[model samples]
Target chain A: MLRYTEDHEWLRAEGEEVVVGITAHAAEQLGDVVFIELPEVGREVTKGEEIVVIESVKAASEITAPLAGTITAVNDAVEADPGSVNSDAAAAWFFRIKPTEPDLTGFMDEAAYQAMIG
Target chain B: MADTPGGLRRTPLHDLHLARGARMVPFAGWEMPVQYPMGVLGEHNHTRAKAGLFDVSHMGQIVLRPAVEWPSGHARPAAHEEVNDLKLRLETLVAADVLGIPQGRQRYGLFTTPEGGVLDDLMIADKGDHLLLVVNAANVEADLAHLRTLEGTDVVLLDARSLMALQGPEAEAVLERLVPGVAAMRFMDVAEFDWDGARLWVSRSGYTGEDGFEISIPDHRAVEFAEALLGDEAVALIGLGARDSLRLEAGMPLYGNDMDAGTTPGSAGLGWSIPKVRRTGGARAGGFPGAERILAELAEGAKATRRGLRPEGRAPIREGVPLYEAETGGEPIGTVRSGGFGPTVGGPIATATLPAHLPEGATVWAELRGKRIPATIVPLPFIKPSYKR
Candidate 1:
């Protein structure tokens, strides 16, 4: 199952962990991504904390944690090639977090995400 | 987003920009296009390779002439004697050598405050009949009021015209197709041309550091003119975002960001625009505002000077980020004035006002998102300017 946040982040459940990345709508709005800095793998992050710093050609944006979790792993591929996120935002997961709360009711589903973007 | 403080003013090409899928943003109280669907990076790279059309109509355009009376029901160009009178009067407010500029030419200049700081930066063009001044959009009212303070000069704002810049190497070929004789012009040369019976003022200059022309067209015919230019395969409508990157890559200083009322000409690295005639030990010197401090700084040196910086990583150290000499706690050495990714240079670049005493190749640490990022001081013009000289 997939979950979306109003801030344009997406979460996917994979076994005991959940992967987080930005939506296609967010990537399109960010223009061309040139550089990115991902949080460390062992960093403990709280909800609404800025974890990822993304720089496009014209401006900069920060991606925040949607829920309290410990960063299990960060995507090295996206950091190596920042343009990959623009190419396929859905597949380019930013990080994998072990959430303290397993409940996913707070996040918007696919239809809700589409309606929010609209 | 909602337009604040009443509403935002739109240029003549507002609807045209919407048709081209532009993202409009508020800039200097105007609803200007920040980017197109192609994105700022693409537009920036495209301009470096080919041609890009820009709408700069929000900038202020004004004409200054000698306050002379003419015969009833008729007006005439400023005579040779009156021309000298007009030039000398203008020298009181600006830093450039107004009396030295030849007719049909222009020079980048600055308006200085009475306290030795820069008030605004502008371009002064010699138009024979009158001197033409192009200033920043935010300073329109202030510039008009300042120019009106001149005792023997008449200030008139040219609000009915639209300003467009056709930039890059392919700009000549694209523009020469619609208007002839622009090929003969060189950098900073100003000329008047007629387009379809309408008076077109043409200047062989632009902020992009490319060989281009800034053409002033009437509002009624601006859309037709823009469409005609866009019809060419090489011409694409560029927005302010790419314009910022291009100008920064060219090492150009933005008025509000890099320099302001609190920043002096010496600290702003604008000594090139201050001619010798206005300096000490020269003929006709020391009459303009802030002449004492400006001349002293020119003779000696300013405490602070503008310097180019290359950030450690690809991430840009944006404007207003504090800079420190040490990695940890210490007073900020400087603040980034303007900075972003340099698409042409393939890295991040910035410009800042640093201590003049700092040695060459000194490294200053910029605090980015609470992390210390080291940036090296370097020379300017990260990319060489390609002006047609």
Candidate 2:
């Protein structure tokens, strides 16, 4: 199941881990992404903690963790070519995390996320 | 985000901007387009490569006329004595050599406080019978009030007039199609022409380093003129975002960001704007406000000076980032006033207020996001100005 957060991040459950990336709506708002700083693998993060920093030509923004988890993998491709996030935000996952509890209590479904953005 | 706080005012081209899908943002109490569909980076690169039409009507345009008018309705000769008197009266408020500027010429000037601090920066054009001043948008009210406080001068705020800037290498060619004889006018030359029954006061000058023109037309006819200018294949409607980045790449200092009422012209690295006539050794010296301190700073030097900074990394170091010596980590030596990505330059550049006498090529560090990024002090005007001299 795919879930979304109010911060515009999306998480998709992929077997043992959940893939995370910013929604297309967030990428469009950020314009052309120039650079991104992702947290290192094996780094532990709590829910709502900042894990990634994305910078556009004009400004910068932080991406927060939607659920407590350990970062298992990071997308180096997005780091090398940040525009990929703007090109296809859904497929350009920033990192994958092994969830501590697998409980997405605060995350929203697609319909709820769409309504929030609207 | 659609509705601006405080009910932001809109320019005459507001609807046109919306029709073109502009991302509007509140700027200096006005709802102005920060960028369009092209985005800031694209708009900036386009302006450097081709002509960019900018609606700068939010800027204040004021006309200064002599207190006494000619008795007859017929056009009077260039009243040299009256014009001189008007220039002399204006010299009391600004630090530039207004009287020295010839008719049909424009000069950059600054309104300085009594203590040598800059009140505002403006462009003054000698229009034979009257002097026209183009000032910053936010300082219109205060500038008018300051002018009104002076005696023997008739100040008329051209509130009904809208201003636009067509800037880039192809600007002259694009504008010449609409207004003939524009290419003949050299840099800083001001002329008036009639286009489609509407009069345009054009000056061959602009904020961008490119050779361009600033057109002042009636607000009602502004859209017509703008649409005509946009009809050209080389012209694209640029917004304030690109305008700012373009100026920054040109090493131009913004009024509020680079220098405010607290910063002197000399300290702001704009001493050249104050002509020699207003300096210590000239015939008409020490007459304008803050002449004593300004001249002293001019003769000796200021404690802090504005310098261009080239960051070694790609991170956009924005304004207010503190600066420190790269090798020795101690208290900050300076602060960034304006910093952003220079698309043309292909890196992040900034203008910083550094301690005086920091030679060009000196290495410094900008504290950005807890990381100290190395920066090099370089001569201003990161890019060469392509003005048609």
Candidate 3:
């Protein structure tokens, strides 16, 4: 299940682990991503709190945490090549987290994600 | 996504920019190419190493005609022109008495308000029969209106023309092959030559602080000329992003970022624009707006001036970031004007304005992510200039 936030970050839960990254629309608006600050492993994150800092050539924007979770894993691949977000926003998840509350309901699905982006 | 910015304009190179995989961004109401796949850092460093061709067509390239025909307004002298009898008529807008810049030379100048504040910074080139003026894309309409008033006197202004810049170290060698005589013209000089049947006015000047030329080619042949330059192994197509970084590294100020209606040329560290003749009284020519304040600023010194800042970290410090004194941790002083990660310098750099009293090498803080990033005030052109001069 995928859920979206007003800030354009998306969360997808696979069992207890939830993947987090920005949406396609967010990547488009950011132009090109040069550097990204990934959440550290085992860091506790609260919903709507500052999470990541993505720097493009023109500007830098902070990606806020969309849900309360503990970061379990970070996508080292995307950090090696931040352009993955521009190329494939959905597939290029920034990190995976084990939610403090595993029950995530009323979240955005693929259709809702499309609607939000469109 | 939207086509128009309340009815602004684009350039002939718009399509080319898109075709070259550029990220089109809105700038001054024009859909301009900001950067390409190589990215701003790569493009900037490439230009410094080899040659970078910039499609600065979005900039307004105008030709100002003379009110009279025969003498042709005395060929609208270059910006470097001294304050002398014959050269005196050159500058009608600027309070400084120009009339010194010889034909085919160009200089960076400003349109100051009556209060000594800068209205715009423009490049004035004397094309002999007319003046070739390049103004910021955002200030095109206003600059045109201001120049139109002088049309009836001795100056008649021309509208937009196609201008492209082939900059970097290999620029001269590449351009020299196309226009044979251009190589002879010294830096800051211009030459009239023919390139593939096109009459071009090429100037040995560039904003990147590199030895390069800005070729004023006809609009129709702009794409072809661009292609010809891109074909060179030494040249790569660069976009506005690279242009910004290159200028930042060169310590050149962007009009809207480094200068605006609120800043003065003196305050912007453009003292060279104010000819010594204007200062020493070769002529008491003081009429244009803000003569008193501008002259006084020239006499005394600017209260605040723009300087370069280099943060101690790799993270970029953006504009609007506050500058705090690291020593006292007192109230915020200046703000960042332009900042980016300089690829060549291997660190993040920025241009900012601080109190003139602040000592050079003073450590300051730039608020980033609620943390104060330590930065040092240093001389500009973070990288050594590569100009052939």
Candidate closest to the true structure, highest DockQ: 1
Overall local distance difference test of candidate 3:
0.76
- Stretches of candidate 1 off by over 4 Å are B1-6, B71-74
Q: Which candidate ranks first by lDDT, i.e. highest? A: 1
Q: Write the per-residue lDDT of candidate 1 for residues B1-389, one digit (tens) a residue.
A: 12336588888899999999999988888999999988888899889999999999999999998877767734556797798788888889998898888999999999998898888899999998799999999999988888998997879998789999999999999988889988889999999987788678999999887889999999889999999999999999999999999999999999999998889899998988888888898887868789899889988988888899999888899899999998899999889999999999888999999998887689999998888999999888888999999
**Model 2 RMSD to the real structure?**
2.5
* Residues B1-389, model 3: lDDT tens digits: 22465564567777777788888777888777878877676788889889999877777776655444336545444332222332344365664434656677877677777677777877777666556677787888887777666634343333334788888878889887777877787787877788889888788888887889888877778778888888889988888887887888889988878877788777777766777666645464456677677777877888888988989856788778888887445788888988987777767899998888877798888988778888988998888887656
The CAPRI quality class of candidate 1 comes to: high
Summarize candidate 1's per-residue lDDT along A25-89 as a digit string, tens digits.
Answer: 99988988989999999888999999999998768999999888899999999998888888899
Arranged by DockQ with the best first, the candidates are 1, 2, 3
Q: By TM-score, is 1 or 2 better?
A: 1
Q: lDDT tens string, model 2, B225-309?
A: 9999999999999998889889999999999999998888988999999877888898788777788898899889888999999
TM-score for the A-chain in each candidate structure: 0.97, 0.95, 0.88
Of 1 and 2, the candidate ahead on lDDT is 1
Question: TM-score rank, highest first?
Answer: 1, 2, 3
Q: What fraction of the true Cα-Cα contacts (under 8 Å, chains A to B) does candidate 1 also have?
A: 0.86
Which residue pairs clash within candidate 3? Answer: B34-B241, B63-B158, B64-B157, B65-B156, B78-B101, B81-B100, B81-B101, B82-B100, B87-B99, B114-B290
